[model samples]
Target: MLVNRDNPARSNMLAHMGSLQQAAYTRPIEYQEGRSHGLRGIEVKNGPLRFMSMADRALDIAQIEYRGENLTFLSKPGLNGRNQFDTNGAEAQRSIMGGLFFTCGFENICAPYVTPEGSKYPAGSYPMHGRIRTTPAEHVGSDAYWNEDGQYVLEVSGEMREAELFGENMVLRRRISSVYGTSTITVEDEVTNESFREEPLMWMYHCNFGWPLLDEGAEVVIPSRKATPRDETTAADATPWNEIGAPVDNKPESVYLHDLAADANGRSFAAVVNRRLGLGVVIEFDAADFPYFMEWKSMGSGDYVVGLEPSNSSVHGRGWHERRGDLHTIAPQATERKVVTFAVIEGDAAIDALVARRDALLAA
Candidate 1:
């Protein structure tokens, strides 16, 4: 379970607590203020770790914290209600709220670009990262209980669909699950092509870390064989690609495409740790499913954060992806599944252990 603390069992913990909320639980909520009004959400807490997912935004993780420390970066853009979430004038890049675990792509990803005329996709601007985040979820549900394994389990599941007449139709079913007293939460997603025609798919999980969890000395531990800087300037800069830089004024973000290494089971772990803080965040997933990984280091004064993105394809425009002959597609009615686990590893020992895994991966 990779939980924070281990008790005799769930029964032992349950006996002391008057209610599940005292230790672990899941609750449905609604944002009632400003642009967030009317947006539905579900939050889950297990021990020192707690996170909330937006039911109105493809159920993406909107917040995460540990021991009252903000583990995710939140922008000035208050949570925009359903209708207010438009990418006009680069709103997402300028002011996105739950950037904590922002999801990109149902049809498009990366920078806003226009598909060529007479292309398979309608020739027009794809807008920033598609419409999945603004789409509301349906059939939302939450479950909290002690399982037969004697472990308290928390789950929130929902379905989100993005469709347009004479265009692509994709349905995403997501479930966020965690165990009581554990520091980890797993996100399971299944995306299906509901349209009759084959559709190009570009998916990426944008997991961001904020100031407390991310600092000047914090280092990212990933199993990358090498790195490819996204642009000439980044490539020209001799600063090591994997190193984290201190936040500075007008420090333009640097993006890198990493070539990852995985285990026999295709599982890989990427972590950001600040030994000084004795805190770290570990992300585990199947690299075989997500072949491409991008590191977004934005140490700007206001939006200081590091984004660990696991993607199915390159963030280069859809037309570029197609031209490269690497654009993945789902056959009509085909479904694909992706699972990622985010865990909190605190203390020197835990952080060291997690770093050792990356060391071993690099060696392998």
Candidate 2:
């Protein structure tokens, strides 16, 4: 039976079946200590999805798998296991490239910027992405329970702070949850400024796709009125940005900025569909929180992956946003909240329904 978010009865029914399936297949949610490359972390599994977050590293989602199919790309020399705080700028950036999802930006930098507006530190001192991905999350906890509607919910929550003796004082509280019997994950983040002054807040969700799910013939669908290529390298490949190519050796990566069209609720959706495999993943986010959408297409043989990034700022560095007065800032003691949801759509009917939703939003 198909579960519809708008139909509570159907959803409950699906949840019931999911609970039964859980008894036969697995638990609703399982958390256990996991070690990768001698680094310790926590692995969480809900239904058919599994993800890992290292304690030694920042709060990045290191790996994700659905039904034994690896949905995330893991580059060579995977999971360095090095504590992010101990690593320098270059090392931090290199370690991030392998994870399934890594956050970027907070106060000092995002995308490697050298700017005077940055912390009093000199240019090129801030990391490529901000320290959030490397700044470990404390107060980590997990729970699973049956809701009033009889739906089982699995959740994990944690807090990560970025601060120094005389630097930006910001804290982020994050929670990731999934419902039993569903292939959906929701990530909610609340960032607060604890300092006495306003602070620049830049953030991007780097959701990467790879391997069989990102193989040849897969297409990225976004309902956008216009898209801007980041540079000539991207512009040259913009003609067919919706399509994916076979793994080719030495193919340059392409980046594009999309001006998305949203629904009445100010929410936008994007998806990567592999029709041949009858599988796809959909990302839904609030445009009010993430005003920009960026796509990263790396078709290189070993580095073949695509990123569906939603951000408050363009993929451009902090300096660029500051110059254009586009940087997001939170007043002292103020907080900002954002939410993003990921769901797996399988089979022709489900995929078609997703496409229909996209078309409807575009038509509106």
Candidate 3:
């Protein structure tokens, strides 16, 4: 007769954990019930980056700040309320799965682009476009890895990336295996999948910041010569005009200006003021990577959080050069990379630095 250990419950729990590890790594695995919905496992290390895996579905990241400082997520499965809704309405609602970093305008940029009579844009708007879903599903694969170097990496290929929390650090690497080039993202420290058969087009990087980390007082500074008009037909004509474009420049953080009349060097800059939270956020982009900067202030009244999106193409699937004829194009086998960084700064440091940078760029 085998004797039971001093703590029978402890022994059983250990045995259960061992079994789970074995099953999880058994080459091919399937999760049932609750495990399928919540995070299957989490890897904690470094200062505060938490890596999460949901069954076999997708991957997400949580920052250790803001209570856990939940900052970022790469959601492909469209968790809870995080799925993209129809662009037909004003201020399209973001997926509730969490905070996402990238959104593609399959039909239109803000509102579904249509003829003055209300007809939708042609089908080519989302060429080869398919549904982006969580990992562990068919044809969808996700990987979140970290080494001793303290550098963490997360890749979301087949589909898309989302924001689960307000202020976190999440990094994403995009691969276009068929094209031979890949785009990688390195974000603030806390934050899924899809298919292929068609090449990708009309994708935008939506970076969201809110209260505390990105309060109402946030300011945006660009290094471009000017700002151009944003393509949302309805919102385009609003008082103070919230949208603008830019001409490409090679300098870092060069996409800080705004354009209203679609001029080649027309870019502008602005600051975000949140009266409720008494905070601010500063945004800067690379003109070469993103030729336009669209400024949006939801004023904390609507579901909208302030966003400084860097996009490859313009609304309605128009490339930058379409208007200026100088937009960039990426070949199937070519890869392009863009970087945007946000740090917590107090008082006038953020605004001061932004102003100096903009002035220097304009002078040069």
Steric overlap count per candidate: 1, 0, 65
Candidate 2 vs candidate 3: the lDDT winner is 2
Whole-model lDDT, model 1: 0.81
Model 3, position 311: C-alpha lDDT score: 60
Tens-digit lDDT string for candidate 3 (279-334) = 33443344554554554434323233445666655542443233465333333333
RMSD of 3: 13.6
Candidate 1: regions farther than 4 A off: 1-8, 85-89
Q: Give me candidate 3's TM-score against the actual structure.
A: 0.48
Q: In lDDT terms, how accurate is model 2?
A: 0.75
* Candidate 3 wrongly placed segments (more than 4 Å): 1-100, 105-109, 113-200, 214-216, 223-225, 228-285, 316-335, 339-342, 346-351
Model 1: weakest 10-residue lDDT segment is 84-93
Clash pairs (backbone) in predicted model 1: 3-182
Q: Best by lDDT, which number? A: 1
lDDT of 3 at 4: 36
Q: Which stretches of model 2 miss by more than 4 angstroms?
A: 1-35, 83-87, 108-110, 117-124
Q: How high is the lDDT of residue 21 in model 3?
A: 32
What digit string (tens of lDDT, one per residue) describes model 2 on residues 1-364? 2333465754655577755444322222223333245564666676577777655455567777777787777876566555543346655645664556677778644455556755443334567777777776788776676566656677777888888776688998988778867888788889999998878888888889888889989889898778799998988874488889898899899988998889998888888888888888889998888888899889999998899889888777777776777678889999999888888888889888887887887788
Ranking by lDDT: 1, 2, 3
